[model samples]
Target: MGNAYYKLNKIAESIYYYEKALLLAPNDQEIKTNLSYAQNMTWTL
Candidate 1:
């Protein structure tokens, strides 16, 4: 879900969904990586 948004160049939405997912599974490395990526992309934008 968040990955899809990120690929679509919707960083804000991607981060939103990723944060929501993280709340559910704080230990998920994949989600953490994706959230980090999305955040980095947002900063770069």
Candidate 2:
């Protein structure tokens, strides 16, 4: 899962999973939020 990858500090994997999840539930706020968080992490890196 995205959250699991995020917690493990695997940003790319997290983003990948989150994007896949978004495809299934495009309007999901939680997935959007998590994806945003993962993306922001990339920016910080």
Error of 2 at 44 (Å): 1.2
Please tell me which predicted candidate would have the highest TM-score against the true structure.
2
lDDT of 2 at 37: 83
Q: lDDT of each structure?
A: 0.92, 0.96
Best by lDDT: 2
> Backbone clash tally for model 2?
0
Quote model 1's TM-score. 0.91
lDDT for 32 in candidate 1 is: 98
The per-prediction CA RMSD against the true structure, in angstroms, equals 0.7, 0.5
lDDT per residue for candidate 2 within 1-45, as digits (tens), equals 999999999999999999999999999999999999889999989
Query: Tens digits of per-residue lDDT for model 1 on 18-42?
Result: 9999999999999999999888886
Clashing pairs in 2: none
